[model samples]
Every structure is written in structure tokens, then in C-alpha cells.
Target: MLIPTRVRPSELDRLIAAVDPDLRAPLRGRVDLGGTPLSRATLAAARNSIITPRPLPAPPIAARRIAGVPGAPPVSLYVINQGEPGTRRPAILHIHGGGYVLMRADDTFPQLQTIARAHDCVIVTVDYRLAPETRFPGARDDNEAALRWLHREADSLGVDRSRIAVMGESAGGGHAAMLALAARDRGEVSLVAQILVYPMLDDRTGSRRMPRTGIGEIGWTSAQNRFGWGALLGVAAGSSVVPSGAVPARVPDLAGLPPTFIAVGSIDLFVDEDIDYAHRLIDAGVSTDLMVLDGAYHGFDGAVPDAPVTRRFVASRDAALRRAFTPGGWRRG
Candidate 1:
């Protein structure tokens, strides 16, 4: 298949054209001979580049202590409540994408605000522990604890515990999926749905050792995937084994899980695994919705928000989430 050379979104074309040719080269996927694997500092810088702060802000609805977590520090919950104080709305526990290494509550401000406003739901975006220092289960534990807290205080928060959903992007998406699995096994903290956007599901990097297909169109290369996974798992990039919770795909028995919305760009490295996981969800009797956007790459929605295709992709995701929040039988797409 021939990959079309990506052009800047029409709105940004002039701005992109005005940029120095050298800078534009990198944006166009041209690698710099001098550029090496980002140093810790450089990696941090690269991460920041992708997470542009939302200039406009919305105030959080309100916050209160739900359930006190044992041993760990108190989780400060940020909530955006919709409707009256007594009436309930669907709730979402959002986890931000950052390869499980970097990101903050503020980073997801725009998305949370939009969801809260559009869906009339309470959106809780957590500030979870990062990896390297804090590995697998650390973030998961924090997420679970937060979920438990939310369940306990659902009444006070005007949320229906049964209507709760878990949503996340990238590594956060992986965590959300794992949390759904963990909740199912526990048999108490039932989740209504899971929204996983371009999630990194499998830690078994070698599952497909064949040469990576569609390199340029995919955006994120094999080297970067290994680096992020290695950092999160606290092992060498190509290590022979990875621990459980390190990767969502590592968990077996995806049966009896809630419905799921799994999406990925056709060219994303995670495309194969996401597709496989979606099949597993369906095989296990879980309702699954999958979208494969053409001529797009990993993180395209955020990376190129101005592009028409990117907007269409984002709209599909938002619509999926909205349908999930609907009561009774979910509206099939």
C-alpha cells in the first residue's frame, strides 16, 4: 500500500509553510542525523511538546473525600457534576495518556470539561503515580482505590454506581482496560463500559517480531515503543519477560467484561494488538466497537487536531462515549 505524504491541515498549511524548512522537516517525519535517543531531559521536553496546555479553562464542579485509601496518601478527587444535586448522571473515571510515565490532571482539562459539559456526567481525572520509580500495579492500585472511593460516595456525588465507566488514552487506556478486568474478577466494582483510545495493550513486544510494516505512516516507531515500555516495566527494552499489569494484553480471561470501545489508526503500531483485544472482548461476549481510521497515524487526533480526518476521528470517539453513557441497552453504532 502506498502511503500518501501527509499534508498539514488546510487551516494550518500557511503556518506550517512559514516555519523554517528545517523545523518543518521534523514535523514531516524527517529524522535528524544529529538527533539521538532523547535523554531524560530531552524525553521530558518531547513529551511536553505533544501536550499543549488548553488556553481556555473550565472550573471543576466540586470535590470531596470519597473513601479514605489505606496506607497510600489521600486521593484528592476532582469532580465535574452535572444536573441537580440529587439526580444522578453517568460517571467517567478518566486516565490520561502519557506512556505511563508523564502527564498531569491539568493536561486532560479540555477533554474532561468537554465530556462533563456534553454528556452531563461527572468526570474524574486522576493524578496517578508515574513509572520507573513506581511500576505496574502502582497506577492500577491508585486507579482502583479511586474507583472504590467513587463507588462509596456515588450518592453524595450524584452518580449511579452502576452507570460508571472507565476511559483513558495510550498507557492510561491500557490501565483503564486492566482496571475493568480487575474489577470484573473482584465481582463488586462493576463497570458499565471501557473507552480505550489507541491503547498500548500488550507488553509482549516480541509477539510480532516480523519487520514493522508501514513505518512512516505509523508515526511512533519500534524504537520509541521499546523505550517507553522498558521505562514502565523497569527492564531492558527487549527483555525476555514482562510482569503482569505491565501490559493489558498480558492478562488472560477477558471474559465477562463490560462493553468496550477500542479504536486505533490503521497505521498505529498498536493496531494489531488493539484489533486482537477487541476480538477477544467480542469472543468473551462483551459488546465491542472498533474504528480504524485510514491514512492516519498513532496519536493523530491530538497531533494534528486541525486536520479534517483527525476531527472526524475525534468525533467518532466522542460519539462512542456518548452512546455508552446512554441508559438501558447501549445505542448500537
Candidate 2:
């Protein structure tokens, strides 16, 4: 694991001080959890303690670049040049994970910066508009435009358009998948690959009940998933009918998409959908890699970086990205 060890005793002291004494037991007991999705209110209640988010250490290099200045709406840009430079490097446009509601390019700065530098690629983190405020297509449009912008200005940015990949986590992952589909359909932009981490693929809920013993411990719950999807769709989540662009699962066709790396924690709310989506991609003749992390949940990589499970998660992710971005990409096993 590249992550430095965070002393549990010291970290727990900070967590205990931040949280209510009464809830400490349950939070500490969460070292083991089954697949059952925890309640949103419960998770929210423990946010201050159990789910403490520490910004990743700063990257060695960093910069920002204007991605797009569409005459309509706001001027959107890409945060670029934050990694070590490599000759004939591949470029990746990253979409930050937030269930499509919160978080932004800047919020995930540490992780993105690390990725940019580690991969030695021109990593561009796009600032997509959030849902409810911007609605469905708005976010997708920004993503597509960013890819188009990447292609159009590839020369200026010293990136190879042919080596472009789309990467994101959670809802951002879903958007990255959708962007590949959209780009394929419109013939607007070409993508070399996509990396989706614990992606929330379906707007609709799944019938399979969560299991009780693995990554389910500290991951997002069914309730949280509902809230996120509802907020993004502007309607109750798990609706029998979802409009296009609202959910990747609802998209009619899955053909002609780019190669994809789909990752999910066994206990994640989107686990089922992520699995099914990967299968669908294979069915459509699109190359796909599916990585199922055991004893891990949504945001596990960021949540408990010190855990052995999460250490393997990050290592796997890095290796996957390296393979995906390698001069000649490899196929899934």
C-alpha cells in the first residue's frame, strides 16, 4: 500500500472527540459488516467520526487549464498539469465522485493530483454542473464538451487525442460511462478507455437484498442511494420508469462504447448495477474489466486507507489504471 499508516489509536482519539460518546461503540464495531445497506440517517449521524475525510497530501505538480467557455451557461474549465511529465503520455479527463450532488474537482484534489502525477499523464479534472440545479443533460453535456474540447485542443495541451481516457468514481463513474456511450453515438469524440470506481450505475434500485458480512460495513446505504438518485432525477428514486440520461442502466443501447474498467466494492449500493453493467458491456462486444473488491464498500479507498482491504483496493486501482493507460492496453481476464 502506498498510503502511509494512520495510527488507529491516535485516529480513533480524534474521531471519538469529534463524535458523540453514545455512538462510538457502533462506529467502532463497524470494522466488520455484512452486505446489508446501512440507513442514510445512521451514516449521516456518524459522518463526523467514522467517516472522517482527510484531504490527501498535496501533489508534487499542479495547474489549471480552461476546458471550455461555451457562449451559453457558465465558463467551464479543466484543472490540469498537476502530475509529473512523461514523454508521449496518455491523457485522462477525470470526473469527481459525489453521487452527482456534492463534491467537486477541488474537493478530490489530492486523489486526482496523485493520479495525475503517478500516471505521468496530462490529467484534466472537469467541473461539471451539479444536479437539481443543472438537471440531467447539463452534467453530461459538460462532460461531452470537455472530451470534445480535449480532442479539439489536444495539440495545444500537448496531449495525444488518440490516447484519451475518461475516469471517475461513484456517480461521476456513471457519467463517465454515459459519456463514452454518447461519444460513440454522436461520433463526436473517441475514448481510449474508462475507469469507473464503485460507480453508481442505475437510477433504479435492485431487487437483490444486500448481504450481511463483507464490505457492507461502512458503505453507502440503500436510503442514501435513493436520496442521491431522487435528487438527481427530481423525482422519487426506484421509479419503474426513468427517463434517458437519468441512469446509465436506463440507456437503451450499450453498443459502440469504448473499453471500460468497472470497479465496485461487494457491499456498495451500486454493486449489482455495476456488475450487470459490466456484463452488458461485454455482451455489446466492448472490452471490459470488472474488479470486485471484497470486504470493501463505497468510498472505501478514501474512507479507510489504512485498512488492508483498502490498501489492496488502491493498489488494484493503480495497477488497473496503469494497464488501461499503457501504450497498448490489455484485455480483461
Leading candidate by TM-score: 1
Query: In candidate 1, which residue ranges exceed 4 Å CA deviation?
Result: 1-52, 55-69, 82-84, 206-211, 216-219, 237-240, 331-333
Residue 307, candidate 1: Cα error in Å is 2.8
Tell me the lDDT of candidate 2: 0.66
Residue 169 in model 2: shift from native, Å? 0.7
RMSD score of candidate 2 (Å):
7.4
Clashes of each: 0, 6
TM-score of 2: 0.77
Tell me the tens digit of each residue's lDDT in model 2 across 1-333: 001112344454543343323323434633233322323443333322333235455443344444433643653555455322233567888887776766656666667667777777777777788765667777887887778877776776667777888988888898888787788788967787888888877766532244343322244655556666776777677777766766888787787777788888665667778899998888988788888875455676665556666666677777867777775765632
TM-score of 1: 0.81
Give the CA lDDT, 0 to 100, for residue 83 in model 2: 28
Residue ranges of candidate 2 with Cα displaced over 4 Å: 1-26, 29-71, 82-87, 206-217, 331-333
Q: Weakest 10 consecutive residues, lDDT, candidate 1?
A: 1-10
In Å, residue 249's CA in model 2 sits off its true spot by 1.2
Best-performing candidate as measured by lDDT:
1
